[model samples]
Target chain A: MADRAAVPQAPELTARRRSGLPRAASPAVVLAMLAIATLAAVVLFMTLDLRGNLGYVLPRRAVKVAAMLLVAVAVGLSTLMFQTVTANRILTPSIMGFDSLYLFIQTALVFAVGGSTLATAPVVGKFAAEVLLMVLFSGLLYRWLFTGGARSLHLMLLVGIVLGTLFRGGSSLLQRLMDPSEYIILQDLFFASFNQVDPALLWASAAVVGAIAAAAWRLRHTLDVLALGRDTAVNLGVDHRRVVSWVLLMCSVLVAVSTALVGPVTFFGLLVVSLGYQLCREYSHRWLLPIVGLLGAVALIGGQLVLEQVFGFDTALSIIIEFAGGILFLFLLLKGSLK
Target chain B: MIRLSGVCKSYGTARVVDQVSAEIPSEGVTSIIGPNGAGKSTLLSLISRLQPMDAGSVAVGGLDVAATGSRELARTMAILRQENHLTMRLKVRDLVAFGRFPHSGGRPTAEDRGHIEYALEQLDLLTLADRFVDELSGGQRQRAFIAMVLAQDTGYLLLDEPLNNLDMKHSVEMMRLLRRLADELGKTVVVVIHDINFASCYSDTILAMRGGRLLHQGTPGQIMQPEVLREVYDIDIRIEEIDGNRIGVYFA
Candidate 1:
């Protein structure tokens, strides 16, 4: 009742003018265009070189693009689905402490066994270990809460935030006590950068992201119902507990994979999903999910290209995105559009 | 019949609905009325399975609400709570189309379109079908939500304070529509209403609750007395028969 927009009178004319502007610009069309735009960005990134050393540059660029795309899909889809289940727009899956947990795991690994052990460990093995620990903690906790005690979603959200603070504090304390050389390794790993995605971990991240996307696709309709808020969803006969539990578990895995692949871009999901909402009118995930994924990919690929070619490695892509995304976040809060 | 057997719900030390055991007949309109905090809305929520009970069970059409699958229960009953809000920018038509989700699973069939049209027409909202739900006036939005529930076309409807936004004329019209829904469509409606005159004029049965317990459940003729009204509302209410309806005058 409070958030009603002051719609213009006689929307008929505005709709007619809009129709003229885009004869074939439905939400599906918008999503397809975004996909194409991302594809174009990828092509431009790959073949923009005047030297034209295709063999020398294409594989390396392709690997980077693939890693970015995987992380994009993971973050975008997880945050979108999490917002729907929580019935609010102000939150992302990062609130579940997965990002801080990622940091904590990295710090604990370094603190317990030292930096050389982690550096010496196979990339796949270390990635697998980090992802496995997060998945187990999140999945088991969700299962116990949803199936065993079956508490309220409000309670779960509060618990998640508190746990996030605890993890962050724990990691910070560990960071301060660590050896200076070990601290460097931890800092390098904790900072999110699209430039440093490991080639070895790319395949595993892709597989995990693919599995998550498929699961999300199957539950797309149910997810739309969930966006109606808990009471209405229950009124429409949704198995609220079961659906929320599964979605939370999936969000954990997605967040873990994305953070492990590209460190932690806390606001990338917010940027993509907000842009996705602005770009499309449809509420159905069929349009929204793809649009957000494509937008994320485009943003990362384009931002990286500009950073490389224009800035000449002056800064990390994550900083620019976080800065812009953080401003957008503040604007949305002030605009009271978070719901 | 909608039956509540020993149903209970509580928050902290206060019981909002305590061991509510009653059978609501599967015909006509039934009004549950009492002062604020009298468990009227909570009872409706329990019957609709919108809230889990701390103890006991509610059964509708002989199926236990706790045991029935959500999809199956949705086919049998629909509930509309007060204070409905949407985070999505949905037009009236799109919002009403969601009523058919339990049947069509988000892909509207031709028959679903028919139901949508019928609902829109019933709410006199056909002209405003394309308007965004958030753009409408309070009453219009209320009507749109009612139309969505009507589009579900379930055998039973449980509504909590549906008249919260309506004007005097619209309130009468809305009550008449519910009467027609019950008399013509053979649906059972349980409404938590505030105005006693509307209840007396429209409902076939009345359930008066007080202090989280059922104080009285009987036909309007049997339960609309000043004594029963005084007991339920904790105030002296004078009953006057006007236009063949037992109108309770509690304003004084």
Candidate 2:
């Protein structure tokens, strides 16, 4: 009777396929777009003829572009990893307050040593100190939470937000007490600026990012499983604790590297990652991760290039990017779409 | 066969699953029935090695669950919990494809696709395979998760409250599917169930637990009696035969 009528015809599969976009287009299109974006960034950065002396402008822009790309990749990958591990779409690595901790250290250093002494401090030494301190703070927090099994991801997120507030409070108090001259130096470290990057730290950051990427590539398959959440992931043969720890460690190193490189850019990763997911519908990390990495590079490099070429460097690119990203975050939050 | 020897789990000073020991039959639907907080879910978690037991050993198919490699263990046994709060927006088909992870390790082959399709068809999710899991109704989502576990195609399936959010029709479909998996495919099915009638009608055996202890274990015929039901659930349940199936009715 009704059962016979419910026997769907072959055409139904086609109807079902129409509702969702064909999976075939996702990986290929996303990869092609990423490849094109990467190529465009490199070509534009290298061969945008300008009136400035080639000797000075060429090397300087190259370093700045490299710094932006590194920050983009590192932040993008870390945010993705954070969301995967915590199993929350809206949770970013910044929710864990790594960037605020970085700020706190910078403020404390200035407060302790005074601004004059801080400026004269070797650039290499300062960068290394920042990276080391960032890693130590994140490592201690994540390792404890991951191993304890008592703290849920929600609890960790709340704790991290509170910690961030505390750090910001401490930094603000220190800033108020510090002389105006020292405040200026510390302020430069607050907003992400590509122009102020230390060339000496570039090689070290490159090595760190490469090593983390290699580690992440090895565990990419496990990350797909990890995205299924803790219990299911464990059932599916993923060593849940070990894999989560490794991912968090890699995230820590990446965050430390990027934070040290171009300073902290809070919403940049969120902007690129949300765009990456829309660009690629597939859940496979093999495609998703790299697409995210490239999208990040494109956002930074392309945005910087446009700012320089089109706008003639009237304003810093971070201000524009931060403004746009901040608005996007608010939009996502207000629309209740970040879950 | 799955065996738990003196299994005990605790959080801080409180014993959640106190020194419980039991052996589960190797095949068919074995229902662990209990009131809330009876440690049925905890026991299932320990058996599947999802949660580490404080002081006990569990073995499935002659392999020590704690000592065996997780990937190796995954090939042999699969588990489904009630809550599936996935952060990723995965299609139903893609989520089911993950069932072959233990065998294919995230690389789906032709055989994996066949398994995924079969699972989808079995759970009546073929039409909804392309839809995001979050977009489905509660029953549809439950079926989607069951499809994922069924696609795993392991020797053993441990399900914790598979019928949690399912409606009448879907719950019956789920039970029938479990029965078929056990009867036709020879899979070992262990489920933590709350509804006594579903357990009495569909399960081959019933293991009743109360106050973190194994209250009773026997064939459904033995455990479905009025007295046993009263002892386990502290409710006046009348067992009546419906088409030769013992149906327990607990309502006034």
Candidate 3:
């Protein structure tokens, strides 16, 4: 029996090899390539032009790189988890109103308490409050939708889109009514920028993202099972509802960290995750999460470098990413690959 | 043995599986048969704990399914639903390797690999082991899913419409394989099958359900009568003896 089983696999293996299609690169090789690229981008971004005082230029560059890397990890990990939980490649935490919620909170605070007082508030406290609010809102939504039983993915997506539109509309209305000076401050918060990231807020974001990353690493295997869909995962002994709830909670926290740190990034996560899926052949989260993280780092650091060096800061990195990501979204929709 | 007492399930105002109570004995092939909307699949889901009961309880191998941990229940009973759709790309070997998750927790040991190879051989899937599951034909994909459940290596197996997409040759082969697993390995196999003739020929016990209740439960000789099948299906089905096996003729 063993000999017969062994015999058939060999011919098929040889047949596949003889075929003209190029074999996929192994996950390890892909990971190594991405890691090297990310490192090169970081090095180039940090030391490409080293004129002026070393102390002033070096520390500022370090802070900017740190902020970019943090956002990359935060956005990449969160988007991957969100796609797994929702079982759709097209969905991301940002699309589900997470960034818009952050925008709404900023707008609301400016509308209610005046922009000067908000800016004067202690940075850590304000960051903590924003993080807490985002987490609580996501927690309540996940608990309500998933705890009782399995809810349709369509229903969840619908709710997310509706809420996202509501937040965006509410923020715009507030901005329309606010004082011109306050609106200017609010405008700065609307566009995602790695510059001007508070050093203290960066530390807090790192701690939160680090703790969540550690937790998510332990669930790497379970996440693979989850990608099989709810019934199959449950049959394999996964507490489907509980695991999904926890994953959503982790995604919300990661999104909160990234959004709070660098303002709202609408399609950066979508772009990173989509590219990661195309480049990596493996389905396991153990490989996928890191590949995605490295991919995000490379995209951000590399894009920022190109924008600064090649374009001379003519445009923001987020605009280019969102443009490409938005086109891909439309392509995926037209292709009907949402499955 | 799997026992259900006063198990009930409802969707809104519609009762899907109402007060279903039956004991499925171990060490044989048992088949559940009924017309559409008869709750055959729903009853199987309730027993597997894939769907929670609206009212009563289910016990599998003397363990309360609700109270036991999901992993423990998984080691004892494995179920396959009617439709299995995967959104990600996965090789056939990788899909089957998931069956070992209950035991190996995603890290397959040597023994787990042995079982996986055995299942692949049993399902005649070794030739397609390297192929992507999404690229396979419908019948081949169905067999791949069956191979996955077989690799689970549980004491009890529950399958809903396992032969839905299979051709006649593969369907008979599948039934014969299930019979051999029950007779030779002492596995308790339960299937929700649509073809009454296959159920009658292969199953030691036949359960006929109608309108969310078990209308009849007996051996093939007892439940294959035209009257019993008529009451369950709301149509006349003639039973014929062929090769000493009861076969139902429902066409025409």
Candidate 4:
């Protein structure tokens, strides 16, 4: 009695699954490939120039590698988690103005107390202040504006962009008025330099980043549901607002550590996570977090190696990453895949 | 059983759901019918806690939706809205597997897989279970979503306009499915439906809502009268009894 003729014959799903290569290889296999890529980058970064004193140079390079990994984990996890909570693929946690916020904080410090004291001040105090402010700024934004729905997500993004513009605009104004010598000092702080990273702050950053990564891992299941949108997630009985707040807080810490380490590198997360999503076809964050983090590590280490070895340190690595990431942004926009 | 007491919601100046209070009985197919801007969807949203209430509370099966743990509430009740847009590409089977999340927490056990398989067959989607949801037609996608909710295996199911993109055959198939869910499975099915005749034919009880308040809630036979239909829709509708089901003809 039913009209069977109207049913569009869906392609034979059984046949397709049998032949699907993406599904045929388990997510673990993909992760192994990413792991191998990371190991190759590490080996190349370590022994490419074997002439330097193994004792001094290897440890220093090892420290740089570790710093890069910390940033990679922070950026990768934060961006993916942020996209999950906001239910959009194109957005990054940096859009929350954390980058500009960091800039504003540094510029304000230099503007208030002069750059010399800041450079000489106890490293612990300055580092703690920056990290704390990042946490506070993200918490304030999440509390004041981010309310766990599509309307709120858009409004938050708009407010963040506006706030970012204001922060950067204000910093620029201060820089213009600053003494020439002090402006140079502030400029040094602004341009991300992977060439020289302070060894003292590395341990603290690892502790903090490690803690946040653990927290994110614990909530990976919740993030998977949150990505399903507010309605479906709430129906599934997820405490949407609470989970979002935790995620925002975690993102704040992650972004703070990364920005604090290497200044601010925008769009790096987008490139890494976008590639992760493409490579790893699963929705569960358990598989996604590691995949994205490892991908980020490979990108950072490989790019730095090329800049140092191939290009003779003539250019900063962030510039190349930013350019490629910018192109990816435009491509994603033109493709209209982001919703 | 779902109980709503003094439930109200407002958007800016307009009160979308105004102190709506009703006790929906368990174990039957119930359809909410109303004209546009009538607060039918808003009421459902409030009850499901998808949208917060300005001044009210909803309790499902004696558990306070506001106070209950999210996973616990999810285990008790499931609600599906009309529109679903996903940012991630997902296979139909994976999407349906998410229904077991409230139970399995993303790890699918053999039992969860059984539910997923059963839901697929129930919705006539076993053949297309491996297909991507986005690749399917609108009606097939709707069925896929329905299958996901059904796989949740909750005691109570709240659906808002589940038939939005379906043609006549699929719409009838959906209604019959819900009818079986209520009659055979003894699940409490609450649906927001636009078709008055379908509401009368498939639902054991039909609730009439207009202007953010419940106008009437009764058996299909009681709500099928021309006077009640006019009060709810603001239009004259002639009703006829066919095969022991009330059918409303609104055509001139």
The CAPRI-style docking tier of model 1 reads: medium
State every prediction's TM-score relative to the real structure: 0.92, 0.89, 0.94, 0.93
DockQ-better candidate, 3 vs 4:
3
Q: What would the per-residue lDDT of candidate 4 be over residues B1-252, giving only the tens digit for each residue?
A: 999999889999999888788889999999999999999988988888888799989999999987888889899999999889788888999888888889987778999999999999999998998888889999899898889899999999999999989999889999999999998999999999999989999998888999999999999999999999999999999999899998998888
The residue-level lDDT of candidate 2 at A287 comes to 81
Task: Give stretches of model 3 more than 4 Å off.
Answer: A1-23, A109-114, A146-156, A176-182
Report how far residue B249 has shifted in candidate 3, in Å: 1.0
lDDT of 2 at A40: 89
Residue A208's lDDT in candidate 3: 90
Best by lDDT: 3
> Whole-model Cα lDDT per candidate?
0.85, 0.85, 0.89, 0.87
Stretches > 4 Å off in candidate 1: A1-24, A50-54, A139-163
Give the true-contact fraction for every prediction, in order. Answer: 0.67, 0.82, 0.76, 0.73
Clashing pairs in 2: none
Q: Candidate 4 lDDT, tens digit per residue, A1-339?
A: 255753444446556776765545678998998899999999999888778578988888988998898889999999999889888887787766878787888888889989888889987689899778878876876654555445644456577789889989999999998888999988876777776778888889898888888888888887888888888888876888888888888888888788878878888999999998887877789999999999999999999999998899999989998999989978987798644
| Per-residue alpha-carbon lDDT of candidate 2 for residues B51-116, written as tens digits (9 for 90 to 100) | 899898999999999999999999999999878777778899999998999999888899999999
- The 10 consecutive residues of candidate 1 chain A with the worst lDDT sum are A145-154
Q: Please give the DockQ score of every candidate, comma-separated.
A: 0.60, 0.61, 0.65, 0.57
Give the docking tier of candidate 3.
Answer: medium
